[model samples]
Target: MTVLHALAATLSRAGRLARAAASGPDWWRGAALYAAVLALNFVGVWVSIRLIAWNKAFFDALGALDGQTALRQVGVFFLLVSASAGSWLAADWLRKRLLILWRGQLTAQALDLWLGGWAYWQLRPGFGAVPVENPDQRVAEDCRKFVEGLLEFTLDLISGAVALVSFVALLWSLSTFALPACFAGQVTLGGLMQLASAFSQVTTALSWFIFFNRDPAGFVAVCERLDGLMAAARAPAPLPGAPQAILRTASPDGALHLQGLRLATPDGRWLPALPDCTIRPGARVWNSGASGEGKTTLLAAIGGIWLSGEGRIAVPEARFLTLPAGAPVFAEGLAAAACYPEDPATQGSAKLNAVLTRLGLGHRLDTADEAALSGLSMGERQRLGLARAALLRPDWLVMDEATSALDPAFEADLMTWLSAELP
Candidate 1:
């Protein structure tokens, strides 16, 4: 089966399992504990943000030689640290409690299903379509491992999402144009105040000594230039005209329909108009044109990415996969990299090796580490892209010069295999 088919099957089974688990009597209690754990995690995150702010204040005080303020910040530091530690400890305890509670419930349910339906007799080897190799271990040990893994992965995902949002917000605040303006204003004001104090001192000295000095106009000029540069950087450029209304509708039948299509750049410059056309389902199209002829743009518009044009495009309601000229590889293992968008553990090693070998990439399978997978040559990466398409078996596949790096014979062989496999 294709990866997509297996994934669908897995999801169907998971849905049933979820419904079964939710129907249990103590499901609400388990959910409540889980919610409490998540709430405590949020509290811990808030405390961490507070601690970060405290670090800035403490360091500023130290830099200014203010021992009293520094000592007070240190005291606040301990309070925040205590709150953080307490929140995490409580969360960890609740998490463990929820794990055992869910584990017990799951194990009981598994036992009931295994014994009540006589699955132990029917699911034995050579009896059922998919035999249970070790039903005993599956019932007793797998239940515990499943619950532990579920809770651990779920918590890790939540923490990662929260951290991503926090970092993005911090970066946005730091990068705002207003931040630079604020710093520049403070610096300019300080320089002006110092200049005024020096002028006053020099004037008093001049009255006594009758000495002449050159005017200090250069400092003021430099400040004015700096202000001008900041203002220019903050100024907003004129935006382009509103994009044309390009109505995109989903096709009921598995075909691509383009009617009255005209492409344009974001700045409103028009490209060559495309003729009204309908591509039948399963058609392999090759768009050949000179460079700068908007071929890539046309593909982008068809993919619903670039819509600065006028026309109606009807796209099929099917799984669509796009492979660009430079196929990107993630820092994952070989099987995971090949069968992306699907769990790596779900893909068998033999299948991965077969696909890589078919595409002339089997040699790198053993040698390619997670870090090295991303640094593969262009041809190898393109082969990996083809491998994904073959394994995924999407309904509609789009490529924009995806095989440009491969040699003629090898590309032809890969395409032949894909056509036969995908057909």
Candidate 2:
């Protein structure tokens, strides 16, 4: 069963690679560069063979004590040497070009799929999708190594195949050189040597890469990780526990509906269940309870973002945004962080300054540089989050104690501000 699954996965991966190659930019793709590099490499091998023949002639001239012939052979030696060196240099250049093109093409596609449809968010540890550790390494370094090693192996294979086919004929033509007549003439020992040489090259190359190097393992690990990321992203939301747990994507505005709503823990157990209820549009509502109560869970359920357990939530398809108790600030500068989810320039600097001042971040009115936001305390960050929400004015804002980090008076002031601003 595992073998069969492995075969299926290999085929799927190959198909995906083929499609990516086809879809990539026509002029700048890796395959075309690789093909050109392969041709240049074959030329290099052919030049190398010529240089070997040049060696024989140059030595024969010296053995015969022919200064003229030896001098001529010296010039022939230099010519072949230059040609071989040029071929090697060109092939090396093209091989590197192929690496970058392939890495860029693959990494861009992987990032697109990984970030598609909010998969990055959903694939967190406690979220529905399976978490992928070291995703940054997987995307950046893994993509680079995968492309580099694949191109290296592929070029070597092509070179070995070309050498086997062409050099065997060259060997057959030179059968008079060293091999016994019975072997080279009757059994074709020279051709056999060529085949052995090609086979040995392949064996040595693959053995070194797989056994003595880390690239093969890295390639396999990256492949499996990227495959899992795609699989998790493509997975559908879990089915509702029963017909009672209906999911509404588009309901009328301000009409929050909940029927037998049950929120499940990450492990699939129903932890907090809410009875049927409706909070109509424009309703002034406050939900309070101890830590174990379903207050936060209820908000998640009502927002139609919670996926587990039994019940229906008919929340409107309005511009819904949630502000968690611990608000997140980015390192994208004060203005950018404050105006997140909307471009900072959309609202003018004056309005942003007013909101920041109201949220007690008035000192940051002139702070637009990208110094790390890590210096901001939790409460200060929450203040920025509130400022962001206030500036954007979302239609259905769900606050999960978004003001919890603030002092009591400031918390009350922020809540009142939310009520006046959001309503």
Best by TM-score: 2
TM-score of 2: 0.77
| C-alpha lDDT values of all predictions | 0.69, 0.68
| Tens digits of lDDT, candidate 2, 1-423 | 998997678658645653553367653456577778888878877765665466556666666687998899788878877887887898898888777776677778778867765556555665553566767777787677666656666677677667656655555565554457555464343344444454444454445444644455566665676666556666634333322244655456558877776677645666655668777766767788788766886776665545566766777767877888877777677888888878999989899888888887888655556554647888988888898788888877778888788889878878887789876
Cα deviation of 340, candidate 1, in Å: 1.2
Give model 1's TM-score versus the native structure: 0.46
Which candidate wins on lDDT? 1
lDDT tens digits, residues 51-106, model 1?
54565577667767889999999899899989989999999999989888887886
